[model samples]
Target: MKFEVGDKVVIQHSNDEGEVVEIINDKMVLVDVRGVKFPAYTDQLDFPYFKRFTEKKLFPAEKKPKKYIDQLPPEKPAPGKKKERIAQLADGVWLTFLPVFDSDEFGDDVVESLKIYLVNNSTLAFNFSYTLTYSGNSDFNLDGALPSMQDFYLHDIPFANLNDNPVFGCDFSLMTPDRKLAEHYEASLKLRAKQVFGRIEEIRKKGEATFSFKLFDEYPLRPYEEEKPVDTLGLGKLAGSGFRIYEASNGAAAYGVGEERA
Candidate 1:
């Protein structure tokens, strides 16, 4: 008999019942049994209605009175809440690369691509700008704010592009509320093909998912300078000194005394 989709059928040799999900051909059909799909011959499947009716008629079910209890069963105690544990990381900004592998039945794996991430493991928040370049050509550029103890995702690099040395540059500034601005920090890293291959081999040996290199240990800050009143008239220092100030061609001040320029 031919089976259509959505027809309930039973296997001819076994008691397993399933639904015909798709008719592959005149002789083959797709059956879904317990949420698993497999191909079976159409002749091996039959309608389950006859089998269910025959079983119900041959062995009739007996009905019994419902039992009632005076007391309810004890309830199970609720489980206590678990405390969350924070991960402790080293203090620095890091550049990490995670390799994606494609493996075959021969157990040989090839690197398909790489996932890049910028890790900010320090306590300070910073606004950062990043640029990636190869062979004097810019590949990627991004600017954003990164929170403390967080990671930012950069673009991926294909395995083939690793042969070309890529340069990564990052500029960071503190996100502070103070009026005095701190000096910006700059860092650059150049990746060579040999260096990356060595790191990848190391990761494969150690069974690590990612390889990381520290960009900087700590963020540098500029020294704070006290404010002082400006000398607008420039008369304070000229009171006793006989030197005369002359403006040079380069817009610099030249001092002279008695026709002798210094």
Candidate 2:
């Protein structure tokens, strides 16, 4: 009756379905399917089957031109005097795709930001990824940084203004105030992060730290999006304690360590 990582479920009465994405807080599964991932409330999705596919079952459907989510109608790109889009890019059972070489300017900016966040938080030790929008340019391909940074920034939503719920997916904070600030930082990273970045810290870099966040009894992920592709966490059942952030991973059992499996 409960779903964990790797559960194949249809969307209630619909044929649309996917594997569980990462359990962001609790009672939610980040779902992955057809090369995209999203957050979904468990109750919203019905699971009538299990173990239908293996890690080996996953294979590239075919070769095609890599399209940017920005090109999609549902999503818009930054225009003149327009602010750039930046937010946390998450998919099911997060298997980090640290595409640092994904872009040129953004890639370097994120690396610089990560370093800054680490120093500000002072917890030390961190695991952050950048989104890389594939351009098919092998020579231009940072191989990793570009794409990763691209995706990371793509999901970089408004953290500064919490009154608007949240655009950024997840953020860690040693203290509530810090969490608020981190959330704000995420929101304003693209808008105004120079001064904000000056005052934060990272976990891994430090010996140890703890984090807390608002928990969700059930959260349905965004069903499809290329930039923030879906993931398959396969969380069969989750604890009410929600998710715990120790160091820099999802948790102790998450994907074997602080994160859901890919």
Tell me each candidate's TM-score: 0.54, 0.24
User: What count of clashes does model 1 give?
Assistant: 0
Query: Which one is best on lDDT?
Result: 1
Off by over 4 Å in 2: 49-262
Candidate 2 residue-wise lDDT, 1-262, digit = tens: 5678887877553457667756533444566755445445566667655423332356777888988888867747767531111213222112221111112454432321121111111222223332222232211111112221122212322323222222222322223233212222111112124323332234224311111122111223224435854435533233334754344444556547555557
- Candidate 1 is scored at a TM of 0.54
Tens-digit lDDT track for model 1 on 1-262?
8889999999776678989996655656667776645556677778898677666755557887765675557769999732210112367998877666666588687777777878887878888999988887999999988787777778778878877778989998888733454568889899887888899999669644568888899887566788988979785688558755545553342333335445
- Deviation in Å, model 1, residue 69 alpha carbon: 34
* Alpha-carbon RMSD to native, per candidate: 16.0, 30.7
Q: Could you tell me the lDDT of residue 155 within candidate 1?
A: 73
Output the worst ten-in-a-row residue range by lDDT, candidate 1.
Answer: 81-90
